[model samples]
Target: MMVFTKYLEDFLMKCSTIGRNSATGRLAIGVGHESYESSHLQPSQWYGEVRELCGLANRPCTFPCTNNLSPSEAAEALNDHIASICQQLPPLDTTRLPAYLPARLIAPTVSQFQVLQKLEKTRVKRGTIPLDLPMHLIKEFAMELATPLTSIINASLQQSKCPSQWKTVFVTAIGKTQSPSSFGELRPIAITPLPSLLCESFATDWAYQDLAPSVDRRHFGNMRSSSTTHCLVSFLDFVLTHLDKRKSSVTSIFIDFKKAFDLVDHITVISKAAASMGIRECLFP
Candidate 1:
């Protein structure tokens, strides 16, 4: 797995170098948004395996391997990835603009109406009783429904007075997706938060607190040893501030890089890791 992660790390260094330069070339230019639906397989397990082999815990990403690559190689790889991103969109000039994130948020909302519907059903079920219902039981149901609604409403009201500063961006440089069909889809586009503001939750929030105790001791030890939350939050804030400045719409692509970890080209990743470490790419390749 470690070997595989090395390969993937190299690939990302190459890609990031490719992409970053492309972004710089047209900085003053505007952007636009596009809406489309695509399907793919989820490749997170593969990514995870490779990451484990590489002795990585938590979400595996490219930043760790950056230091290992030469400045020139890193720049080149970033250029490639940037070029890839540019290839997907309409041409941009000083006038045209794109807002990519909003469209991305909407697409998932459209795709998951069914899940939301299930939640509604759950809400209904929670309200119902066997007709031999106890009054106290009915009261409890009412209390249950009230809690989430109250929480949401209160949070909103509290936030109302605050500046609408939800501009955080979480970039998933590579990711995987699962389709209802037999196979999955994969892509190598950077995925920011739909609103860009909810990135805080992605990076900082604990989705479920109760499960922590049950997790393996090895995993816990790993978590303690390998943590980057503080640094990530600082970077997230920086990107959000930078991205939020666009006056025009930006093209945000919320893509699922299916089996991103597994599908990573091992040789490419290894090369990147080796380069980062001041080892010659030729030797590793």
Candidate 2:
């Protein structure tokens, strides 16, 4: 466990440093909203209303605008919010994490509606029977399986061989739009082994929280407390301010990659990471 955590911390630290150096002159931002169409709405017009709605619901709203304020006012509020969140976050401890945090092992409780909604959204065989397993049963099985799984994973880590079961995944295609009958517009979703999935999910969350503070705020692809809207607003504010001050046009370029994740070479990524972190041993040995 100590070895695993140290490896992750060291790797992430190096990755963060690489990210910061790479983003020296680049602007990165996130744009997140519950609804994708919300992007079309002008921030100045709907910011206050959405903020008020979020306040009434007692949740953190990621809307970029606040109180329908002017650009300067909105910029100030956004900066203050970012600063406050950054200040309030607890510092990451690099010594060692507990071998097994029970909270991390536990699966999140979901309501029946949520479960049904997920089932509805899943693109499985027409007339497929959904699993009737209860949360308690899953939890019990996970708890019982943890010891052996951990031992296997640790052994594999030492030997550099990943367990075959962890690599198995079931792929399903879901339509991009409502009531689509064609296959071309469908998106592929991979369903992985539950235990492995849960472990990876927990590890991802831990890494994100642990490394977020040290990561460059400009690089916002996958970090905690940052969203697409936040990125968009920040960039927009900067552009507006620049134009107003210098009365000069700004050039912007957008690049979209298709199947970006599928195109990545995992071996290259792992090799680069190992090299960057100075891990001399063969990762797969």
**Could you estimate the TM-score for every candidate?**
0.18, 0.45
lDDT scores in order = 0.38, 0.46
Alpha-carbon error at 195 in model 1, in Å? Answer: 44
What TM-score should be assigned to candidate 2? Answer: 0.45
Local error of candidate 1 at residue 285 (angstroms): 12
Off by over 4 Å in 1: 1-251, 279-285
**Per-residue C-alpha lDDT of model 2 across residues 43-63, encoded as one tens digit per residue:** 332333333433422343233
| CA lDDT, candidate 1, residue 265 | 52
Candidate 1 lDDT for residue 231: 46
